[model samples]
Target chain A: MASPPRLRAENLRSALAGPFDVSVAAGRCLAVTGASGSGKSLFLRMIADLDPNTGEVWLDGRARSAFTAPAWRRAVAYAAAEPGWWTETVADHFPDLPAARAMAARLGLKEALLDGPVLRLSTGEKQRLALARTLLRASPVLLLDEPTGPLDEDSVGRAEALMRERLAGGAAIVMVTHDPAQAARIGDEHLVMRAGKLEPP
Target chain B: MNPIVLTPRDLAVAAILLLVDAALSVALRLGLTRALGIAAVRMVLQLLFIGYVLQRVFAIASPWLTLGVLLLMTAVAAREVAARPERKLRRYGNEAVGLIAVGFATAIASILALTTALRPAPWYDARYAIPLAGIVLGNVLNAASLALDHLLGGVVREKPAIEAQLCLGATIGQAMAPLRRAAVRRGMLPVINQMSAAGLVTLPGIMTGQILAGLDPIQAVKYQILLMFLLSGGSGLSAVAIVYLAGHRLTDARHRLRLDRLA
Candidate 1:
């Protein structure tokens, strides 16, 4: 098993990185629920090393700062709430066709969206598509910020189920959400963040 | 040498006016003033400094110095624009080099062949090389800066729609394609606009300078066309190079996000 929460952050903080002071375990999905603007997204960003903070974070017993930026980012994959569309076409978005198509269908999207212009997709469709992209990397630690926050009830359920099915392999999952039901259903552990601090539950 | 005609009172008034403009530029950005005072000051200061530096450089006439200056300018601009403290800056420095080089080389090569080669002047002549190279590099720098800014900002702006793709195993390049397009478009837009408006809308700086130097209007027009074409090519090439180079820099050893550097 990956050793107990080894990533270190002395006073990690940012617009979206953190003021976080906790470590997370591998293979455990830690669900974060908190008030709006309570730094939950920032906390996850801190873990991903995507923002600047005073503290140190360790991955696999190595200091995050010690690793080059690209290495550190690659180790932890973060999926934001709205996700970006870097390309016009779906095939362009997903270089690897089979995986993209399979993940798309798994997330209840029509594989037809792959050939279609991404600009035409609805918000829920985008959310589903973003998840498909994340699944492509298959990172060991998945940091999700409201992965389904923009989706409808049906899409939310579909995404939640997809997350449950896809994330395994001793990978750590840190997710931020407002829905308590999602917290209960998706998380193996729960933490409520407010005013830049995480309350262990 | 340029003639000096201003009196002390005029100089003082001019200085005061410049200072006032400086104050207004930053104030405008901050809503503290109504004009771009700081921007005007910054532009004047930067241009004046470059003017003095180039005057000395032209006097000394060293080719290596020319190349060194170009490299230093490219590095500094890259770092300046890449200043997202939370985002990594080092890798982009090298990538910026690649972008600037494409612009620099292409500009030099085109001009050397078209004008200098046709006339066969000394390759190191500052009168020709300095202004021409500056024009090329300046255009490239602008494009590269825009491209990088758009790429990083676009990612932040549209991250969620991207993250789901990450869950499904999308490569970083795959994830970033949409952003790359946005960035390139943003970078190259100015060049496109300039190309579209070449003659009728504005009197281009090069052609105007040539006319002042006693070149005929027809000759000046040719020079302007050559320069505009150089700038357009430089901008386009630099934009493409910066994107590709940055794409390479963005990934880690395992081809994952450069999370640590993002901070």
Candidate 2:
């Protein structure tokens, strides 16, 4: 029999989104798609424990309540659709400049992008850099919202490739996307959110 | 040197000064004429009441009375500090914390000054303790309020950045470090400016009052210097303490951003 889910959510309900359940096994991707304003991002946020909700989220069979918010966040990383940057230089966000450069390169970012200030980056660049930052966290479970929304075809491919590498490395991923073809290609299990309920695609 | 005492006639002459200010306000349509009139009445009433109260309290020289006055001032200061934040603590939360912080800061500075520089018989002399505590409490209260206001505003404005840091595995302190630093700098700005401008752009109140009361100019300046140093230390301590205390309240034991605590 396959092992239990690496990330699990039971009865997760926000005021806007209802009591939903989800489970993703190791080395698998669960893609959640929904219409605009359909609580897709809210669902992702609930899983990441960023928003207030009623639910039990289990990581590696351990309840989320067992971990501090910081530790839990470290285990279950979140990449927001509209990411926030605080520092001036892009390199300031990363722990290792060379490693960040490598991740940037993998994400199709130019080497010089890391040296420039974050304000100078394009929306696409900022999104990709945010992805790089999230991935650098090395969490076991990843929650991504519109990871490719701002990207070009080449960068989307690069991002998908990176997600594939992580999935192959036994990390569980719950991604929110609008593209059906991308879902079919990358998702191990696909769920559509309608009227705040998760259903089979 | 005999200080010039202001009699009733002298005070009436001083009241004419308000007419000049009122005239200017009326000419400029500053809308401050009524405010100035009300303030003049209020200042006279408040000062007179305090003057009588101080005379009675000093005549008795009771430690209990001295302590009561200090505590009352601190409580009032705490309330003033608690009132300015947009995101207030659950009723009396910031006020209680403010009380303790402002009280402790005022006590430390007052005790140090009273014991060493200007020690009086019986230590808790109303003349020394009450006035010193009032000055310290007033300055410290402003600093604490400014710190909390900046902190609340910063947290709201930088919610995305703060949440981003938390999502990246940063602890509450780690996520809030930049905001806290900025808040502290902003909170201390007025005090810092006062320090820089003292005797240059403006004559500080304590110095001007002392000089007018016929103290030697050099002696008044020395006392002013001492007060400046005391206020800097007291305000800095109160500002930092309030920030740290309030910052902790903004998060939970799990180090989550309790943005809901904010308005």
Tens digits of per-residue lDDT, candidate 1, A100-165, equal: 888888778898998999789998888888777776776667788898888788878878776775
Candidate 2 residue spans exceeding 4 A from truth: A13-18, A35-38, A52-55, A194-196, B90-92
Q: Write the per-residue lDDT of candidate 2 for residues A109-132, one digit (tens) a residue.
A: 898999899889999999999999
Per-residue CA lDDT of model 1 for B92-167, tens digit only, reads 5544545454545455544664465344356656656666666677677777778776766655566655544443
DockQ for all candidate structures vs. native: 0.17, 0.66
TM-score of each: 0.56, 0.92
Q: Model 2's A-chain: what TM-score?
A: 0.97
TM accuracy, model 2: 0.92
What is the lDDT of every predicted structure here?
A: 0.69, 0.87
User: Which sections of candidate 1 miss by over 4 Å?
Assistant: A6-11, A15-18, A152-154, A166-168, B1-263
